[model samples]
Target: MYDVVIVGAGPAGLSAARMAAEAGLKVALIDDQPRIGGQYFRHAGVRRIGGILAPRFGRARYIHTSLSTLGRCGVEVLNEATVVEISADRTLTVAFRGSITQLQGENVVIATGARERVIPFPGWTTPGVIGAGAAQNLMKASGVLPGSRVVVVGANPLCLLAATSLLRCGVKIVAVCAPSRPRVTFNALLRLMRRPDIFLRGVGYLLMLKLYRIRMLSDYRVTDVIGDAKVTGVITRRFAEGLPPSEERLDVDLIVVNDGLLPNIELASRAGCEIEWEPSTSVWSPKRNADFETTIPHVYAVGDCVTASGVENSLLEGEIVAISIAASKDVGERGRLRRLSRLKWRWRRLQKFRSAVVELTVKESLDQRPLTDDTIVCRCEDVSLATINDALCQGVQDLNALKAETRVCMGRCQGRTCMHTVLALLATAVGKEPDQFKPPVPRLPLRPVKVGDWLKKF
Candidate 1:
C-alpha cells in the first residue's frame, strides 16, 4: 500500500507525486506510456524527430528535472502500467506487461489527462486525414511527418500551433482554416492578454503564418474532404450570419483537424465519482472540491482531466492537490495554509483565461454546419448520422437505448470518439439539455485485455 497512487505521469501527476514524496509519504506514479511525460510534455524535446524544428521540440528541462526529483525523492514510477479499474476502497487494478495487480492507495489521484475531440466530417476517415493531436504525436514521437502538404482545420488555437510546427519542419502548409469569426477571436484575444505568455505564443503562431504568406481563413469551415481512399483535398466554405456562404476548394495531400479536447473522466466515473456537465465544452468532468478531491473519499483529480485548461493550470493544480494530500498527514510545512491559499488564488485567476480559450476555440465550432446523413458518426461500427437520426426519430431517448438501437457507441472505442456528438444530437432531437439525459455507466477493463491474460491475473 502506498500513501498515494497517482494515475498519470504528466505535469500534474509528477508534481503531485513529488510534493507527496517530499512530505514524507510513499507515492507511486503510474502511466500507460513507456515514458513519463504526459501528452503535453511527451517528446516535448524532439528526441525522435530531428529537423530545423528539433530545438523547438526538445525535451522539456522541467520535466526532466521532475523525473530526476521523483527518483531522488523515492517516488515509485510505474511506466507502461494501465489502470483498468478503481474500487471504492481506493484499490487500483493495473495491467502491465500482460499481467494484472492490485495497488491500494490511502489516497488516489486520477490525472489520466484528456483526449482529442474529433468532429467527424465527410471523408474524415480517409487515409491522409488525421486529428491534429495525432499528427503532433506522429511527428514528435515517431519522427514521421504527417504529410508533405497539409491543410490545418479547426477553431482551436492548437490548430494554428500545429500548422506552425509543421511549417517549421519544412512541411508545406496549404492554409489554416478556423470556423471562428473575427469578432469572437478579437474578444478572446483581449481576454488572452491577461496571460501574456499564452497570448504571445498564439500571436507568434499567427505571425509565422503571415510571414509565410499562408492563408489564415477566418470564419471558414471544412464542409467536405474531397477524396476517396486517400485525402486529395478539402472543400471549405466561409460562413457569415447574413451573407451567403462562399465556397473554396484547396488541394492538399493531408487534412489535419481538431475540434478541441475533452477530459478523460472514465476512471473517475467508474469509481463512482459524481460528474458535472460543463456547457461551455459540452463535456462532463468529475466534480472536485477546492482541494481537488472528488466526491469519493480520498480520491482526487487534477490537470486536463478536470479541465482542458493548459499545462500551466495542470501543474498548479497538481501542486495544490499534493499539498492538500500531504497536509492530511500533518506533514511538516512552513507555510502550508498560506501556500495553499496563494495557489488557489492563482488557479482561480487563471480561470478567466481558460474560459476565454474555451470561448475562442469551441463557441463557433459547436454551431458548425450540421453533419450530413451519410457522414460516419461511429467510425468503428460505421454507424452513420442517418442511422442515429433514425433511431432518435424512433423515440430512442436514452444513451443506452440509442446505443442498443444503432450500435453507435458499442464499437472498439466504446463511445470515446462518437459519444459526445451522439449525445449532443440526441439532446437536440429530444428537446432536452445534454445533462438531462444520463450517460452510459463506465465499465471496468477500460482498455482492451486478452481473456488469457485476464485469467492469468486471477
Candidate 2:
C-alpha cells in the first residue's frame, strides 16, 4: 500500500507526487501514457517542434529536473498502467501490463486530465478529420506530420497554437477558420484585457498568424470536411446569406477540429464524487472544497480533470493538495502551508485568466453550426441527427426511452463523443434546460479487454 496513489501523471499529478515524495511519503504516480509528461507539457521546451523553429535552445531543463527529483526522492512511477476502477475504499483496480492487480492507497488523488469536446458536423467522421490535440500528439510524440497541407478549424486557442506549430514544421497551413463574430471576439478581448499575460498570449496567436500570412476566418465556418476514404479538402462558407452562393474550398488532406475540452470526470464520478454542471463550459466537474479534496473524504481532484483551467493552476493545485496531505500527517505542515498560501495567490490570478479564456473560447465556434438532419451525430453507432430528432418529435420524454428507440448512446464510445450533442438537442426539443437531463451512466471496462486477460491473476 502506498501513502498516495495519483491516477494521472499530468502536470497536477506530477507535482503532487514530487511534493509528497520529498516529504518522505510513499508515492505511486500512475499514467496510461508511455511517459510522465502530460499533454500540456508535451516537449516542454519553449521552442516549438523540438527546436525546428530556431537553431538553438535545448530540451526543457525543468522537465528533466522534475522527473529526476521524483526518482531521487524514491517515488514509484507507474507508466502504462490503466486504472480500471477506483473504489471509495481507496483501492484501485489497475490493469498493469495485460494483467490485473489491486493497489491500495491511504489517500487518492485524481488528475486524469481532459479530452477534446468534438462537435460533429457533416463529414466530420471522415478519416482525415482529427482533433487538434491529436494532431499535436502525432507530430510531437511520434514525429509524424498529420498532413502536408492542413486546415485547423475552430475558435479554440489550442487550434491557433497547433496551426502555429505546424507552420514551424514547414506544413502548409491552408487557413485558420474560427466561427466567431467580430462582436463576440471583441467582447472576449475586452474581458481578457484585465489579465495582461493571457491578453498578450491571445495577441501572440494573432501575431503568429500575421507572421505566417494566414488569414483568420471570423466570417466563415467549416461546414464539412469533404473526402472519400481520406480527407481531400474542406468546405467552408460565410454565415451571411445571399453572398453569390460562394463557398471557400481548401485542398487540405488533414482537417484538425477544435471545440474546446471537458474534464475527464469518469473516474472521479465512479469514485462517488459529487458532480455539478458548469454552465460556462457546458460540462460537469467534481465539487471540491478550498483544499481541493472532493466531496468524498480523502479523495482529491485537481488540474484539467477538474476545470481545464491551465497548467499553472493545475501545478499549484497539485502542490496544495500534497501539502494538505502532509499536514494531516504532521510532516512539515507549517512551512508547506506558507508555500501553499503563496501558490494560492498565483492560482487566483490564473483563475481570472481562465475565466477570460472561457468567455472568449466557448462563446462561438464551428460547433455552433446546426447539423443537417442526415448528419451523423454518433459516429461510433452511425446514428444520425434526423433519427434523434424524430425520436424527440415522437414525444419521447425520457432520454433512456429515446436511446431505446434509436440506440443513440449504445455505441462503443458509450456516448463520450456525442453525449453533449444528444443532451443539447434533447433539451431544446423538450424545452428544458440541458442540466435537467441526466447523462447516461458510464459502464466499466472503459477500454475493451479480453475476457481471458481479465481472469488472469497477478
Q: Candidate 1 local accuracy as lDDT? A: 0.84
Query: What is the lDDT of every predicted structure here?
Result: 0.84, 0.80
Per-residue CA lDDT of candidate 2, range 219-257, in tens?
Answer: 677777777799999999877655553478899999988
Best by TM-score: 1
TM-score of each: 0.95, 0.92
Q: Model 2 residue 348 lDDT?
A: 77
- Scored against the true structure, residue 63 in model 2 reaches a CA lDDT of 69
The C-alpha stretches of model 1 lying farther than 4 A from their native spots are: 44-53, 182-191, 362-367
Model 2 error, position 451 (Å): 1.6
Kindly report which residue pairs in candidate 2 clash with one another: none
